[model samples]
Target: MLIPSELVLSILSYCDGSTLATCQQVCRHWQTLIDHYDALVWSPCCERDFQKGLRRRFWSLDFPDPQMVDAAMLSSYAKPSTLWQSLYRITKHWSLGQCTTSFLTNYTLRQQKRRPCVVVGTTQEYNFFTSLSVAQSGHIVRSNPMYKGTTEGRQAMIVHASFDQDPTLSSFYLEDDALHGIVCHYSHPASPWIVTGGLDGTVSLWNEPERCVARTWQGHRGRVLCVSMNDQVVISGGSDSMIRVWDLDDAEQRGSIDISSYLSERHDWFQGVGEIALNGHLIVCAPDTSGPVLIFSLLTGSLVYELKTEPQDVAFTRLCLTPFYLLTKGEINPSNRNQVPIYPNTSSSSTPTVSSSPYSNTTNSGSSSLSSLSSLSSSTSTAISTYALAPPPSLSLTPYQLSRYYNLSSNNMTTFTAARSCIDVWDLQTGKLVYRLVPPLPATTTASITDIRISPNAAHVFACVEIRDNGSRRNELCYWDFSNHHTAAPSIMVLPSMTSSSFGNAWACFY
Candidate 1:
């Protein structure tokens, strides 16, 4: 029996790529039919696979439009025979994380080689990067901590790194009154607007593409620690212990919650609001102290639940929010020394010790010998003697390795909280701990995780670690692939010490 070409194509549309491939091998007639209606059959498949793969890889479905993708596919593969082949290849490449890393070499060179640039009445300020956010259009928007008056230094800039054009950087600045110390900034995925909060207690929304301030709202009474925005509203938390919600259209304060009441319960007067995250219908606020994380309804501004860490002494610092899950960072209470966990060293050599404990504090006297294994002489010799005299390194289960034992699938939304020296992965639906990842430290180095950011797709976790050796400090960026369960060590990228030193308040996001 023979089937109509249109009917066959429609039937193949419902089949996935693998099924279609198998069907194509059945006969030459089937292959001819697939070739003739390649667009009809493969366009849907391309869109489906691209979106599916992107969501799994990046934890985001914010790719370019289908028509734009189709246009690119047609342009790259004009020949009918290679149409689906090119589409599939690109899809596979994205799925496999086969991406190349390109450093902003020019930006780094300009900073290193060039002399200090003077700005605003001889203030000798250099361009300092505070935060980076990627837009839906593939442009990177970076914010600096400098006041708007300083025109000499690169304050805020936007980089267009889309596929259609060569990468270009453009300076984005605010007006006279709009200038302030922008502590936190956010950009919505579906909008061209950028919302930024400053130490001056002002939240300004800027039209990024136009490089102009749309509106400035003075709602917070103190320094704005964090700000989150959606399509309709913007939520900001400040040092005044208040979380204020504002209407995006009118720039008017809609509702305000006095977090001071919430603060008083935990006796956390010193640590005000540290971080605020808004996802879908929920808003999460984390104080700088050991206060429990407060989750609120986005629409009504009512308390929903409070998520507390296992050890009550661990305090939540940073937070990341997805539609279904919330990730937080917890620091061990500085006042409580007894709460610190001691791990035993597993290495064969007694001289070199590894501490799996995340909260292991290194003193200045011991850092010199452990900074670099190669440089064990000179000032480090005395430190090594002191180290040898000290107790053996503690041994504990490595957190990263523990994550491998879980049989959990990536289909559900998972929350990752980096507490003192450990990362706890929780399933949002069930609120059950899935994995606890502890990064293994080198024998010679004592490291503390400074920050952690899960990629938008949730496939990988990026951790900023500070390593101290012999009183010298270095910063390393660690990348952990969550998708591959069998993978052991995380890939490390060493950031320059000079740049890392200047990054007192920094934020990292993956595109």
Candidate 2:
């Protein structure tokens, strides 16, 4: 008995890539059928593996993987099957942490003999970068803080680097009402405008082509903490507990979500918006309070959902969002702050030291399919009792005060020892905790996360971590790749040593 070709192809559509590959080896007929209907069989597989097809659509051609150079062009004009295959290869390369690094050299010019160009400030006085964003077009824009002896020298400007021609660089100083530097800024892949928030309680939209502030909106009574904009709307979160939205076309007031209004306790400890991620239809934001992470509808300004946390979970200070999942990082409970053990830096020595205690507690929910993985082994339960516990530093400081202090601090230090360290992954549809990810560092390493960036598809997370051990400090770019879930655990890689000074001022973003 033989199955119809149509029925055989339909049956193969339900099988995964591996199963189809196995089936193709069964007979010549099956192999021919599978090859003929490759698109029908593999499109679903690509969607399943690549975050429902978003990753495949936005995968960069100029990836760090040198092998992608050939595949990049193939993906542009290839068939659906070819394009998906190219995407799968790129994702698999990322999962395995395979890449090559290269530095540019210039020997002809004396000034640029060794290094290609300075990455930081325009002038030698203030030669450090505070914030930077990489666009999909390969344009790099970074904010440089300049403080000369005079009033004119105490200004900040946006430095734009374009590699389209001869690796050119230009500086555009954004004028603010208070003359203060930009506090937070965002560059969207789809838009050329750079939206910035400043200490003057204003949000300025700069036209990159024109090199001037196209418009400025003053809605918040306090300094802005985060700003993100697209072609249509500008969204900003300020210290005033207000998430304001403005029309990009005419600078008209669209709407605002007062975070304090949603809090039932009405406590003075509530801080303003910590971070925000915007898509087309919704805005997911986390306030600088332990209350709850709120999601609001972008069109109607109505509350969509609130992701409440456990009592032990402190305030969520950082978060990024997608249609299906929300990625968040919250502070450890103040009571357990000092109880957490610190791991010493072990990347330098031949033998990496493993502490007898686990860094953070891992608990799995019985109802949810998600399971928390503890990176290190041992019993920290008894270690906490051995040492006298000191009062949490935040006991005297309000959450608002803590948030403000973190913003103003140069190192972005945490008052409490282990604050906002663990990354939590939650399912938006089910509203259940999916994964509680602890950075795979030494259990006892005293480290603080300076910056975090998520891939466009939320399949990978990169964190710039600063580790201090034995009076010395170094920086590591630690990344966890979750592309292949069938593996026992996520692939973890902590890049080698970087100077504390240079890495401290560095910022990263996923285009």
Candidate 3:
């Protein structure tokens, strides 16, 4: 019986790595079938490939997985010298790597180390936005403004900063003024929105998405960290260990739940809502509380499944509901805030406090298929592979466990720690820790990470920039774009390493 490739892919859920290798070899038709069904690939594979890139592991190899180190297609991965081979084609984190046509002999060692970046349409790269809040007034609230680089001795910039639009109106106003950005919500009844939990402790929301915040709540004693938005519901978590859900659809605090109360009941030191994962009508909030991620019917707002996290003490950072697995971000300390995670300090990173919760593997068929190919193909470039001095013992992490963790923290911190980074990514399908996307810093490691933001487009891409030490880097917005060539990391070719935030959320209205 001849099975159609598309039909085969249609029925079976693809896991990454070996699963994909097996499926693709079924027949030429299978290969062509899955090629078009790349969405079937697990989300974690993307995270893994990106991690390979940060560690410079992917540069010299064909596959992102270390298992491919001596595979039959080693030549197919990288030809001759490791510096110039590519097994997969990607359009993110736009950086200048190697060229097979020109001989390295023609250039000096320094030239080889130099990353090739050219200015394209825009030049203002600022920071990675943790929770991208587009206020109606064009004011932007940046989580942290820390950037590392040539400015090492300067004051540690706040990981949270606000961009001003108009003090009056509240709305996600798309305007074109040089000094203003979308900041607040419009007080008008027509449109209402609210921004909660930033690098700061403030929690506020407006009645309209295009209007100013009509109410601001300051119940949490700590910084309001992460935020989630759905129909008319806005959920926020913070260092205070509280998960408060606000019904924005109504003009009142229609419904609310306290994560702190649950934490106090459990007698845990850090029992609060660190992050929230949302699916259609279901909501799962990760907390220090001992249970599977707290799941509830998002619309009904009632308790649902409490899947045990298993024996591992893994806390989720990010979660999404779709064809992908129930995803979660890696566990990082709330205070572990250097703001920029360009690379994993595998050598010195502390072993995460193992959780008593049992973690169910989240990898599924759809996400695994895509996850396999990307994971098999990408790694970090040559320049990032080796370093003269490893980070201090306090910051080092083991390379072997790179694929084991996922971090939901931002990579754009504004501190002076050498080991901390701002960027972290995860596989949305399998809940596997894939990679850490660190902002590209200079040789001196001067600027710390500031804020981070991912492209809202179809492509899963994000960007990070260093803080502005002087007035050198300003007038900014976001980093990646899917507009042309369907490329991520568009700023890698068009702007400096850091991005600017002079514009609002879409960053369309540049200052």
Candidate 4:
């Protein structure tokens, strides 16, 4: 017995995609009804499941006109009878870690013998790498230096690689003679604009396709070490112990904070800012292991609060920002006898007292102690910590609105943290520990994870594990699919003994 089409539509509208898929298999009549009104059956579910969540995750990079962005996204899956099909295809592809990789040529290294190279910066859009020799020469010259190339000194090479097309490489030179090398660079995921901090204490913005400097802002007295940006402003930290905020639109200095002066009254010694994370409203600055993590307001440039972990012995290495929380990765100090404590207070003050833990004892804060702590092996004490993006109610109003009130879904979003031989995946939203991926190593062999990167979609994890073989060290690149993490073997790919030139500057991005 077949129900009326009106009744069928009414009944199925309340069901999810999986349920609708089940109903389609009952009979030809039901399948026809399902196919005819596929949009009605899937539109609401798609909006709730995919559209809202992805938009929230990528809110920082989304177009200014969100309605048009929504329309464009929906139009991509506009087939009348295949809306749910397209949604399912995309989700399954990401979950199953079904991706193809093609190696791009190392054009710069191909001309000469392999040299030590380092990755200067990377975003989901592009990867940047440079060799010490090229950086010192202040330019990339061909094998024949006399022959004039299209580009010269202090240049950045851009490569365009797409899934279906071949990669095309080109270079653009910086016009400033004082700019010797690039210390750090950042690429906006949404825009073609690239911001670079140079050794010459100057920051330059470039339009990638045109291969020319759009603007240059000079303020830092020393070389810039870190940079972060959003749609409105660019934030940079340098050896000058100053954090400068620049207006992206006009390339003018909006504000500057002398970190040394900000904390001078409290601590006798303050290291310069090492890394910084800038959302639209808040800035989190990590100076060094000895100093507390300083939180400040972007609008007024006021100190919001200071965060100190118990034991306070961890040397923070990297910081990542999300809409709701700030995450940090560091190495625990084994020399300290106390266990790490979580965030102690969330109040703001002009001069807050540093925590009285043994790690904070001023008497022990000398060069010898610092050098001994630094000499400790990092493999044994690596850890990751999370803190709220803004201070609690008494300190400040909640600056992040997307996650709490808007119902931005944050489930199943995982990030990998490495400690010695094991890698753990944690849910960023809830701070729940999910999976501990252990590399398949021999009992006699000792291994340590050097680096771990998560795919943009958070569905896959890539780890670089180093193992010693007959006194020679080798690196293995391992890939894991989170969907199959519970299985005995979730590793999809393992490339052993990757060469320096081939894999040194490699990064992965999905379309």
The lDDT per prediction is 0.48, 0.50, 0.34, 0.43
User: Candidates ranked by lDDT, best first?
Assistant: 2, 1, 4, 3
lDDT of 4 by residue, 302-378 (tens): 77656554334323334544333344443222332123232111222211122412212322122122112211111
**TM-score ranking, high to low:** 2, 1, 4, 3
Is candidate 1 or 2 superior in lDDT? 2
* Model 2 vs. true fold: TM: 0.60
1 versus 2: better TM-score goes to:
2
Poorest stretch of ten by lDDT in candidate 1: 115-124
The candidate that wins on lDDT is: 2
Worst 10 residues of 2 by lDDT: 367-376
What TM-score does candidate 1 get on C-alpha atoms? 0.54
Candidate 2 residues 1-511, lDDT tens each?
Answer: 9999999988877764445556767899997776566567756654443333222222211122213222323233234344443344334323222222111111122222111111211111233435556443335555544422233555545444333133544434544435645777887444568888877888888876666788888888888888886557989999899999989987777999998888777434666787787766667787765567887878788887788765423456556664355667543445543433222111232211222212111111121111111111111111111111111222223456466556535463444443445556565544555444445544566655545566544345655555666876655555554332222222221111123334343323221
Q: In model 3, which regions exceed 4 Å deviation? A: 1-28, 35-227, 236-243, 248-254, 259-437, 457-488, 491-511
Residue pairs with clashing backbones, model 2 = 331-420, 342-444, 342-445, 343-444, 343-445
- Between the candidate structures 2 and 3, which one is better when assessed by lDDT? 2
Clashes of 3: 116
Looking at model 4, residue 210 earns an lDDT score of: 62
Stretches off by above 4 angstroms in model 4 are 1-181, 257-271, 278-284, 288-311, 322-445, 479-511
RMSD of each: 15.5, 11.1, 15.6, 17.2
lDDT of 3 by residue, 1-511 (tens): 8976556765544344336555667777765554555545423443343323322211111223323222222232233232111222221221111111100111112211111111111122243322333333233322223332124322111111122222343222322111111221111111235443434455566443332345555555666656666546666676676666666655444455565543324333344565575433556676643334666555555655454332234333334332122433222233433332323232332211112101113223333222233323323232232111111211112221221222212343322133333334433322333334333344443332233332221122233233333433332322322112222122121111224453221232120
Backbone N/Cα/C clashes per model: 17, 5, 116, 1
